[model samples]
Target: MRTFCVTGFGKKLKKHNDLLKIESKEDDNDEAKNLLVSPLDFDAVIVSGEHDITTGAIRLLLKNEIDLMILDHFGNPAGYILPCGKSKLIERHETQSRISSSKALCIAKAMCIASMINKISLLRSIQKNTGVDIETHIERIRKMTVQAESCLEINSLQGFECFSTNEYYSALMKIIPAEFNFTGRNRNPPMDPFNSLLGYGYGILYSKIRSAIVKAGLSPYYGVFHASYKNQEALVYDLIEEFRQPIVDRVVLTLIARKQVSSDDFNVTNEGCFFKNNFKKKYAGIILTRLEQEYTYENEKKTFSEIIEAQADILASAILETGKYSPFIYR
Candidate 1:
């Protein structure tokens, strides 16, 4: 199963029998001719920018039980199309019942710990190559993790989590090259190119994790760590914490450090920085490829996509009291 991402203006998607055809109205003739016409092999289709999609394609996607994620102009996930009436009620009941329990707190703390560890690992990897002294920052993050684990309430845990995350970003800024000019993590309208890429990558990751949660027969809105809000995928947010640094942050930092991307790839205005349409497509492709790379986990090699699904299932099992939940800590 693969993910198909459609970007650019005047893109049209249609379903013809078992085949899905994507036609780009752009002037590039070769690009339109190279579009993939095999929809049966796709697990999901992510559509970005202005495009027209046929009802037949939607029907085919639903028939195949494939997810369709739609992203806004700024790369924020706007909505999703998923097959209805497929979730099991018992699983949702278990999920709700466990939300306010000690099990929930434990899972939240574990996520925070894993996030801190991954951030430290990333810093250490950077230090090794750049020969920068990050030991002080690493120890600070470790202390914050210990403090996070001791919290009995969700509010306190969130506070410590934010503190640790801020500290991690501050330390990260020191090690990265001065060209990226990454002062701190900003999201509202990501002020710089680095934050812009991070936000866009995170949105893509959120869509992937949300799909995994739904496939595991769990509700994405009802979460233990993050409170349910209108149209919010809180469970996805909770589960995505441990992966944010390892996946999105690492990818963005690598791109900046290697000078793979430039300021010309983005449009900077008084509002904030935004990736150009073509550059956004290229960036999305990189993240998708990263998600598919194989890695060793729990004595077994698995792709990040498979690991995400496994983690979702583990969370479901924890809710059902069939097993305990453990966050995926990057080694």
Candidate 2:
């Protein structure tokens, strides 16, 4: 299913016969600014910034079991409008709540290890492309993975994971073009263009994983790796580790390597680096396309979207004691 994103201010969505009609309130006479889409066109709608939707349109979406996601100014998910009868497995949530500490640690370690493995694989690809001798960094990350196998506490495992991530970023910085000014990973208000793209990409990834978790009948706030805090979807954070390197980082690095993006694509303000409207739209389209890209898994071709949904199911089965959980390791 596709995801329709609504951006900009003074926009309105309404039901027009069997189709959903979208138009700009600021210029109602402008046909070029209007769009008509079927409810079947997309399974989810992400509304960014200010917009208005008629009750009929909302009813149409709900009738089709479509999700409506609201994004804050930073492109982070503010909330969601799920259908009234969406699954809410109370038993599954109880099982999650009663998970033993040792099992939780096991899951956390597995996720971290899988994440490091994927990072190492990406680093190897980078090494091949840049011809940089980053064997030291690779070895260090490999060592961290080994240590993680025996890591006892969640905090300590995180420490090992963090160190490995630093080395991975360090290796990446060595090969990145000097013009990008990428030194390391930074977020919230990403200082550099690279980080600006990375942060936004992660935000989109978070939304995808969160949606997967919801569809899998799991609680996003209850997680194995990350502790729940106010308004935090800790499980989404946990699952995202295994994907950051393989999904978002790979795409961002390729964009840089091919010189497909430049400083003009971003807006550098005192607040931080942010994407220009044209580039943000294009980059988001690219990220969505990546989700749709297919790869071989279990001798069958599957999209990353399908794999993510499967991972969510795996997590649920683990919590329910029906099956084992293994994070997807990107090669």
Candidate 3:
């Protein structure tokens, strides 16, 4: 699926006949050029920064069944305009509520195992490339996987999951530069540059997964592993587990390794460490590019973005008892 991204400020989208007339300005004093695009050409349009969309253009997008994604200044999805009239909404919610405990446990275990496998894969890859030995952490996670498989309850499974996550971050700390001062995974105000980039990237991924869940007509508040709490998108949290190590972690590490980002690009405030405003746009671009990268999936190449949507649909089918659910494991 094609996704067109509109960035910068003072951008405008207007519907003209069978096309969308896009006007973009880099600065307020500059006269920008207008470009025409067909709504049929892309599956989604992402708007970042300050932009204007005419009512006619909104109608055109809606008529074409195109998703309209609005991104915040930091590139996290603020909101989305998805095609409406989803069928079986009541049935889907009812099925979700009635999912068997055994099935939920099974699904949750699969998700944790997938996450562990991805973590091991990443650690091994990093070790191989950087000549860093994290075999102890890797072995610990391998053992944790066996323990996780035997878990009879979600809480126990989560314990094993948490152990593996700590091991993964500890392994990363060994390889990440000392200047970054990464001391393991901490969030809700990440304390180090490494974690700052990680939190931001994960925020972007979270929004994408949440949008996929919404498009699949499943309630994000209901989940197999993550307990539903007030205002929590538990299912999104649950599903994001499988992709975190492979996507956001990989992206952040790659940026640091390649020197695409450095300590200077971030600032530590009383709130927490964070990327400077200038670096956020560049980091967001890299994350989006990674999402668009193609990888083998079920014998065919599919972008991570496509895979996310497919996984959401698969999960919905499983919850509705129309199909079986499988967690995504990155190679």
Which candidate has the top score in TM-score?
Answer: 1
Clashing residue pairs for model 3: none
Query: lDDT of each model, Cα atoms only?
Result: 0.82, 0.83, 0.82
| lDDT pick, better of 1 and 3 | 3
lDDT of 1 by residue, 110-131 (tens): 8878888898888889889888
Order of models, best TM-score first: 1, 2, 3
150-241, model 3: which lDDT tens digit per residue? 89899999889888888888888899998899888777767878887887777677777877887788888788888644567789989999
**Weakest 10 consecutive residues of candidate 1 by summed lDDT:** 85-94
TM-score per candidate, in order? Answer: 0.93, 0.93, 0.85
Candidate 1 Cα misplacement greater than 4 A, ranges? 26-30, 85-91, 94-100, 228-231
Model 2, span 130-231: residue lDDT tens: 899999999999999999999889999889978998999999888888877898988778888988888877777778888888888888888888864446
TM-score winner between candidates 1 and 2: 1
- Residue range with the least summed lDDT across 10 consecutive positions in model 3: 83-92
Q: Residue 213, candidate 3: how far off, in angstroms?
A: 2.8
**Model 2 spans with C-alpha error above 4 angstroms:** 25-32, 87-91, 228-231
Model 2 TM? 0.93
TM-score of candidate 3 on Cα atoms, chains taken together: 0.85
